[model samples]
Target: MTSTKIIHEKKNSDMKKLLGILLSISLLLAGCSISDKNKDLSQEHLVLSTIWFQKSPEAKALFYQAFNIAKERVVEFNKEEGEKPKAVVVDLDETMIDNSPFQGKMVEEGKPYNPEFWAEWTKLSQAKATPGAKDFTLFCDSIGVEVIYLSNRLTTELEWTMRNLDSLGFAFVTPNNFLLVDETSAKEPRREKVAEQYDIILLLGDNLNDFAEVFQHRGDDWGVSVVEKYKNEFGRRFIIFPNPMYGDWEKSIYNNERGLNENEKFKLRRKAVTAF
Candidate 1:
């Protein structure tokens, strides 16, 4: 080969080697970054989701906004001519009452939900009312509209749940008005029972499942399509509060599977997110 051609070939070979080294270094750096991120995912820290729920002014505003719109809708619904009595069905936790304290406790302990801990929390009867919730319910009461508290809290927790609501000065805490989960978490039957007696003008809750059974246990989309399907009903007949701590929406991330360990859930949560 000519001397010039030999030198040119050597230069091309050197360039290829340099490029390969740079690419390998880049991959190593990316791997380190990912490892660092996962290492810091310790549950000891307060979850950002719970932090947003507990501290954000916007979160408080959403509750107020929901109830304010609900009050207006109540007035409008009452004016309409209907044979059945007007009623509003409200979920307890994170909807009519603030349960972020309980969620915060769990977050502090680096633990997930346990029925035993939940029952103990309920027995305390210390949860306060959500923003504008008490006032809106009182407004409904003044207008002669029945306010029914429909919650998924187990029947065993009924006494403490009632005590907590009563402590918060909520209206209609009686046995007839407060309905707890008896057999299943599906609230459709309880809703149907309420429908038999009242018009059910508005349903207020923090979770979509609180509105309808259709929103529960859907695929990985987490019922986003269902929410879009019922888009118009929001702020009209169904009011939703902000709750980032926990909900049935999380079930979709796990494919509705139970008994997943912390690491499995952590992996699933990371995988469920979209990344550029």
Candidate 2:
């Protein structure tokens, strides 16, 4: 009876060891699978995927030019008696603030741009300032130029936007200086509103619409052509930052339709391209 019991006990111990080995192997395989899945996800192409504003050398150069242009414009505008600038006009997202983390989060979640998600993210009010923006803005403030942030963000997001800017050390002109776009999405009207009181000389932004009305609806290539037509105005009155992560350019390429599946859009994009 004792010998039989010993045999049974040895069998159970061997079975337990076998189970442990199998579990470790299964866990290792699962870890490898997750690693491969992450690699594949990272390879997915999104429009304006490059971090142009965050890491480009050209972007840094452009920021310097913008600062100089703003300084010159302020000086020129102030020359006129009682015509001093009430405020300097700047765009919010991609202009003064960096929203790359929001984009990164979307990529990680495998989700596209949704208004609800963006609205919630705005409420977080944790966006950092773009490189060189803080320094440029501080210089502007030192010279008595009030900072006005004009954004396409909804009115409901205004409080959060202001809080984000304030948290990032951005000084505001007045509560009114934070201009939220109306339902129309026409920036020309907003510019006109700013021009009424402020000696609006230099306009700073990442998109062409920030500089002129023509780029409001145009694509990046067309906007580039239009800007070339008025190259003289660039670096003088209009200062543009680099924003390759997302913009009207991508919308133009995709025909502004969010319903198109990723595969269908990629096929269409490939068809549209022609070899020179």
Minimum summed lDDT over a 10-residue window in model 1 is located at 37-46
lDDT of 2 by residue, 133-219 (tens): 877778777878777788899888887888888788876635697888667676888888888888775788888787778766565
Cα miss at 34, model 2 (Å)? 14
| Per-candidate total of colliding backbone pairs | 0, 0
Residue-level lDDT of model 1, residues 136-179, one tens digit each, is 87899999999999999988888888888888888887888888
How many Å off is the CA of 264 in candidate 1? 0.9
- Choose the strongest candidate by TM-score: 1
Name the lDDT of candidate 2: 0.75
**How close to the true structure is residue 180 of candidate 1, measured as C-alpha lDDT?**
90
